[model samples]
Structure formats: structure tokens, C-alpha cells
Target: MWGTSRWVRRMAQGLVLIASAGLAGAALAGPTLTIGAIVPQSWPSTAEGEELVLGMQLAIKTWPGQPAPTLVIKDSACDPRKAENAARELVAAKVDLVLGSWCAIGIAPRVVAEAGLPFVSANAERLPKAPDGVLQLGRIELYIVEKLAADLRAATGLRVGGRTSCWMNFEPVLREQYDAVLCPVLGFDKKRWEQAEATFTAAHRRPFTASVARGYAAMEAGLAQLRRIRGGKSASNDPIMTIFGPLPPTDVPAQADAMQLVLSPKLPKLSPRDQAAVTQLLQTKACTCLADNSCSKPGPWADQPFVVRGNVPKCPTLAAASPR
Candidate 1:
């Protein structure tokens, strides 16, 4: 949160488009379908966001036939104002559709609403209702919920650990939805993520008041309290994992840091189900959401599982994976 004047100026100026906004991948043969993607290219704190972009780039390269469509990678920098600017640029470029918004707060729909193009997300919280031509690859939050739910169902035949056994950072904007919708769906009765969303449509209110470190501290503290109250252990009693939304994918540093954070000394192995799903994706270079979308040939491997771990936040050009 800079200043009102700076924020207004940024809203108009757009992100620092340091990387050349070029067409990704080798020149393909077809009519060259064009899709715009806004990624968090410069941030250092968003991991889920980076992973998602990898999913999208993989889709465009391997799915849209051998000759992949031209993907214009723009740096939204995970900022709403920059996102708005990116949307305008995409519309101006006349892309067939917008791949999706980089950050959850960045409503890509609002940006390119007039463009008459589909706003699709390989990953994102499915808008309660699809906004006009918008389509999320999968219900974003559901990924975590589904992953945890399946595990829970196996552990306990019940829906949500038989009661409130967990807590999470709840987005204030989506508080009603969580209290009324998601938590109930997950079977969480009392314990839940205590974090709040970070924005406001009404303008008078601000989102969260702490920085990333502070927020994480708060989230961790609440989670510890919930775990203690719920009488849970790390592996056996506390078998359930927490659900955080996709980090800013467009941001490479964020993704890399996230990878280290989530996959290091603590828990790094994917379950058999997850391993299979990821392997299937890499083998076919295809997407679970659509047959038409796939990754580059001989794409990510079980061990490797990704490409371009930096600011780009994606599996790089097929060329990058296997330099031509």
C-alpha cells in the first residue's frame, strides 16, 4: 500500500513490462490462435501463481496441436491496477481469449469484459457463477479442498474430520462464502483458516493490514492454536493439509521460494494419486480440464516436473525444455 496518489498513478501506468512481451515458443504453422496471459513476473512472494502459469504454458504448447498458438506473456506483476492495464492491452492486441488472471484479486473479467473474449483459468477459484465468457480450469480452492477432502474421506468416512479440526486464513471479502459455503462443504465446523482476503469493492475498507511475513505469522499462530485444540499430531492425528490459494504464478521468485518452502525438509513427496496425475499430465502433456490443452512434447518429468523456475513462472518454450 503505497499512497493514494501513487496507487492512482500505477493504476494508469501498468506494471514494469521489463521482459519483452513476445510470442512464446517457436513459430507454428496454423492460423496462430492468440491468447493473452497476465502473470506475476516480478514478485517474490507468490508460489501457487507461478505453478499455475506453468500449467497454462504447458497447455498452449502441447495442446493446440504441434504448432502451438502465439502466447503473449504480459507482466501483470500481481497487481490489480497492472492487471487492468494488461487487460486493456490484450483487448487492444485482439487476442482470441484471455488465459486468465494472474492473481485472485485481479478480476480479469473486469479488465477485458468488453473484449468479448473468454477469460479462462487453468487454476482459479471458480467464480460462484461464470462471469459472462469467463471459465476457470478448475475450482481453484477446490483443488486444496478436494485433495484434503479425499484424504479425509479415507481417514474418516465423514466429510470434514467429523468436526472443526483445522483453521486457515479467510479472505474478509469471501468471509460470508467461507462461513456459509466452503468451510461447511469441507466439513469444518469450528476450526478454519483465520486469514482474510486482501481487497475491497466498497473502497472505504482496506484489505489486510500486515505484510507477507506478518500474515504468515498470524496464519501459523492460528493454525497452531487450532491444531492444539483439535488434538492433532503432525503425521497421524494432523493428517490433513492446509489450503492456501494459488500464489502469484506470474512471479518466478515467489514460485521458487514457494517450492522450497512447501517441498523441502518437511513434506516433499506427492501421494500415489498425485504422482499419477502429474505423470499423466507430463506424458500426454495434456490438461485434466481440457483435451484440447496440453503441454509440450516430452514435457515435465516426474522428478523435474517444471520448467523456467524464475520470473516467467512456467514450463518454458518446448525449445527451452529441449533446446532445438
Candidate 2:
């Protein structure tokens, strides 16, 4: 009876060793660290929020040298409450870093950061004084609004350009929260811009005019239309010739308008087309910024192309700037 018991004990010990070895091998084969992504899968205009997942995937593809982090994606659908719940789950999962809520669900990364985890946020431009481990990316709305004015003026030769701006205070604040780069460029006093916006708003509508604010596009398009109807020769009628304004009023489009540029709610990172748009605006004999003398010395905002490179669309303004 003693001999039989000893044999059974030896067998059990061997089995345990094998199991432990197998588990170690599996751990070695799997990702050493995990990254959680909280994003909106649906609701609240899925178009902009959908890029949250894609951007992280792109980041992963770019980070081969770094210890490849395992990505776990959770959908918060741009909801604040659900995002908090998702944050708790990720914390429980013991993720090393988090990327999420590309569209201003401020609580998601705050939870991660509070947990002392590393996080990268593509949005929530108003995210204030995050913990040391957090980094926010992109530009803001004032720059876009300001650039819109510049681009329109440069393109159309209209001194005042157009106003399709949603002039409410929260609207600009919301725009600022999404972008950081525009912090340097946004005018300190937007009162005149606001007054212009009011004048424009009273006249037309803006686009994407949703729960947050009115659209700047409605007034923009209306100004274009009215200018054309009036048969005025100032380039504002041509839109393509002007560097318009901070923003005008807008009406939502029949089809959702394609995002013309990426914003940070704070700064402007001119997209290639936007750069070209601004550059072309400069070429239109309407670029007042260039006349400021500082611009003549190849300052910033130079090297912006007016046409999408490798595609030659007819921009008479650019042709005019190109020396014959």
C-alpha cells in the first residue's frame, strides 16, 4: 500500500511540471503587454469616430521596434457613462497603455491616466492638465477658422472673405478642445470675428449644425451664392479665389460633407489640400499675410501647395502666381 501511494504522488508531480512548462511557453509566445482602445463603434455620427480604431492600428504598424503591445478594442460609442464602464474593464484587464475616445469622451483616458498608465489621445481637445503619461495629438478650430478666412481671402481676393461661422462661445471652446496647434494662432479678441459671424449667421446657415453648435458652412455657401447672384467681380463670388473667415453659418449638407481637414480643437495642421488651398489663396493676389513682411522671408506656412500634388486642376490664381 505504501509503494502504490508513492507512485501516484510521483505521477502527479510530473503532470504539474508539464502543465507549468506549457503555460510558460504560451506566455512567451503571446504579447508581453496589452493596449486597450476605447472608441465609438456607433452612434453620434460614426464617421469621425470610426478613425479611432484605424489610427491605433496604424500606430501599431509603425511601432515594430517597441515591444509589440496587444490591442484590445472596446466601444464606448462616444457615450460618457459607457466610456467610464469601459475604463473600469480595461483597468481590470491590466493593460499597459490605452488609446481611445478620439472624439472628446474626456473620462476614458482620464481613468487610464489616473491608474498611472500610459495613454495617447487623438482627441478631446479640451483635455486639461492631464497626468504626465498622457499625450494629445492634432490642431485646433481657431486656426481652421482663421485659416478658412485666410484661404478664402487668398483664393478669392475678398478682404473680409465670408462668414459661415457658428459664433457661440461654446462652439469655439469646443473647437479649441479638439486642437492644440491653433492655440498660437487664434486671435485674442474674436469679438469682431464674432460680430462678423453674427452678421453672417443672420444671413445664412452652417453645416454639421448639430447638438453642439451651428454650422459655419451655411453662411459660407450662401455668401458664395449671393455673391454670384449679385454679379460682383470681387473674388469672394468665386470662393475658389478667396481666403474666407474664422467661420460663417452653415446648414447640414444633404450628404454629410467629407471632412475637409483634421482639427485638434486647438490648432490647425493643414491637410495637404488645405495647404494647397492656403498656398493657392496666397497666390491669388489676396494674401495679406504675405504682405506683412514677416511672410516675405520664408516664414512658417510657406511651402504649402495650392493644388493636390501630381494632379493639375485649373487654379487660375496659382497660374497667376507662377512666373511665365
Best by lDDT: 2
Clashes of each: 27, 65
Candidate 2 C-alpha lDDT tens digits along 1-324: 999999999999999999999889876454456767676677554643443344344334434333455678787776778888888899989976666544544577678878877565543132445555454432233223356446544543333221222221112222332321111111212443344344434544532122111112212222233233234442341222111222211221111111122222222455676566545433332233343343244423343322111112232221111101
Query: In candidate 1, what residue range of length 10 has the lowest lDDT sum?
Result: 256-265
- How accurate locally, in lDDT, is each candidate? 0.38, 0.42
Candidate 1, which segments miss by more than 4 Å at Cα? 1-30, 46-53, 64-66, 138-324
lDDT by residue for model 1 over 15-77, one digit each (tens)?
Answer: 333222222333223355666777666653354334434434433432425445566777766
Q: What are the per-model C-alpha RMSD values against the true structure?
A: 24.0, 20.5
Question: lDDT, candidate 2, residue 3?
Answer: 95
TM-score of 1: 0.34
Model 2 spans with C-alpha error above 4 angstroms: 1-31, 47-50, 65-67, 124-126, 139-324
